[model samples]
Target chain A: MKRIFTPAFLLLTAQSFAQDIKPEMADSFRSSGKIYVVVCVAAIVLTGLLVYLITIDRKVSKLERDLKSLDKTSN
Target chain B: MNIKKNWWKAITCVLLFYTVIEGFLGAVPARDILNETIRNLYFHVPMWFGMMTLLFISVIYGIKHLHNGAMRSDLIAREAAHTGVIMGVLGLITGSLWARYTWGTWWTQDTKLNGAAITMLIYFAYFILRGSVEDEQKRARLSAVYSIFAFVMMIVFVMILPRMEDSLHPGNGGNPAFSKYDLDSKMRLVFYPAVLGWVLLGVWIMSVRIRIASISEALLNHSDTHPTS
Candidate 1:
């Protein structure tokens, strides 16, 4: 009985160890709070691109206005 | 820059800013084979959505051109297609990078990936078709017809075909979509807004391209009218 119990106990412990192996994630990075750095960098790049797009949009609007005036003057 | 006129652009900025911040910081289900890369859903999926939306707009403009024979409509269709292709290419590259780490291959013969590549090639051919034609009216008419065909083909390749067969991509084949498992309520908070933001950004870019095209067309006409100037 004692011998049988020992092996059963071993199997239970092995199963518990297996269950402990959870899927790995960036827990350490999050815990360290350095993930904000990445978030900030991405936000900055997106902001820059959006700003550039706005400038292009404004330039196009100006060009259209100028073209309209030019057409009026020529007519 | 007018708040009332460009409210959507403001929404685009706000939604994207929220997505960027929440996407990284948000809690996600830990699953094997995906792990942290699952966060890519917010970024990668939105590209495809944006492409689809832009392409749909392109086809609508193509139809408008066909009906009215308007050069402006043709220009809008062309520029929208151009922007859609850009978004599709970005989607492909980002998907490839994500696959490299998770799927263990940079390129696979998967149905979805191959379908996307084929769709992009078809659009590239659309541009070539336009370039090959020398006459303006002829080019507009021909490309408008071709854009309709191309848009249909895109739908087939990217949408229909992928679902008809087994694909490595989620939501295809026998595999369940991320929404069924990993894309929990938390991710949805970011995912839906990300889709909206990216689609808006694509439209903004397409609008800019269309404006630029209009300016060029106007300049050409002006030069033709006054050759000395």
Candidate 2:
């Protein structure tokens, strides 16, 4: 009887401890569906930056073309 | 830009858009201390990957310059290194922000952190060494040799040393990398593409810098030959 009681008591305590301690996460924020707002903001910023980079790339290509023409005329 | 030639830039745009959206919406393994900030893995880790790729390109150009004695190779090497430094700075800042929320401090004496700092300083010295040389040929020769040496040192500090000792950063010291256990299959779907996208972005910036440098050099030569214009 004593041996059985000791093991049972330990198991009960362990189960309670496991249930009491859980890692914290932003489940509430996610459940509310506001994560889409964050995602959209990030996407917009990235798109804006990429557009600027494309313009710079086009300008460089124009410069290269002009230089090639100048070389042909000079030669 | 030609569609065939510039397809990779379009891919970059698509991959990044996917990353930003999927990264936030995707499910992650629940773990203590990390929580929501575990999402940073998608953004922060990619910066280091991009930096390493740019620096590796720099080393390749350095070797090419030595082999062919081409100033064009030297220009590429310099621009690659510049872009690499920019990526590294971004990596450091993002890592610090992640650490502050997760590690409870803005800075710590972690092995990987210090290794990254030392590597940055070594590259900084490489730049300073280049600036001090007056002769272009001599400067190119000296810096090419130094770039090779610096790349080796970077591999040592950022990769090898961190693994040999105890480090707070994962994948170092005996700690398993995030991929081994923490990064589930769902997270990997975003992570790999994020690495590729960020690395491609670094290459794009480096290429732009190289083009600008070449244009300026050509303009300078044109002015020298025809002062009337």
Candidate 3:
């Protein structure tokens, strides 16, 4: 499938590459685009883990309730 | 109606607002040698400071929890460790970015960088250690001990590593700490608040997470006592 690159994606990519950083020395601060991808993915994964932890609290309560009801019925 | 509980949230919001404003202002103007790169110091150094602050608090809580078996202190310790990890991640990211611009590499085996990386790895193991144990009391006890160990290791790594080896980083190998020549009065103006604001923000985030954990714990306990079925 031929995927078209939309203007939005292009803008986002451009913005990420863009920086106002000036080097302390004469060296270029340019990083490989791949490194940026890796770091961004890591940040996203960490955020997702936090979201998952937040949601899991609900299921934990539900399980506890089920256990209590089972005990009640047995007794 | 609930005013006292909201203080931390209010503080969080204010600190975040200040971070953004200070960060932006850090960008607007600067002299030579610093220029835009100085802005990275505002974010990077503050994160390191916050990470250390959280870890130190965690160690204190750990000591209290172990000595007295106070669940609240244990909870505080766990939350502080989690917040420390988050700040550690931020520091690494910002430092790596700063390095990419200044050193032309995403990473180098310099003394400070190595020390920072090792400290990060040690905290990553903190979570692993927690997960390996299942008994609530045992997990808390073991993690508390380990947290103190990790905190000490962190300090040693930061303080001792740079001195033992030479590095391109500013303050290493006989280089004077807090050199006014490297860090001028203008930089200091932004630097101090940057550290304080970020440390407060880290604490605020940890407090929110801890409250959520406590509420969730209560909800679980309630379900155990009263079943819906």
Please tell me which model should have the higher lDDT, number 2 or number 3. Answer: 2
Question: Once superposed on the true structure, which residue ranges of model 3 sit more than 4 Å away at CA?
Answer: A1-75, B1-19, B26-34, B176-178, B181-183
Model 2 ranges with Cα > 4 A deviation = A1-21, B181-183
The per-model lDDT (C-alpha) reads 0.88, 0.88, 0.70
Ranked by TM-score, the better of candidates 1 and 3 is: 1
Give the TM-score of candidate 2 (chain A).
Answer: 0.67
Q: Tens digit of lDDT per residue, candidate 2, span B80-148?
A: 999999999999999999999989988899889999998899999989999999999899999999999
Q: Clash number for every model?
A: 0, 0, 0
Candidate 3: which pairs clash? none
> Please, what are the lDDT tens digits per residue for candidate 3 over residues A4-75?
323333444455446575333212222222323433564465456445543554455465566557657745
A1-75 in candidate 1: lDDT tens per residue? 335544544554454457667787776565555667898899999999999999999999999999999999887
Tens digits of per-residue lDDT, candidate 1, B45-117, equal 9999999999899989989988999889889988999999999999999999999999999999998999999
lDDT of 3 at A72: 70
Model 3: residue B204 alpha-carbon error in angstroms: 0.6
* TM-score attained by model 2: 0.92
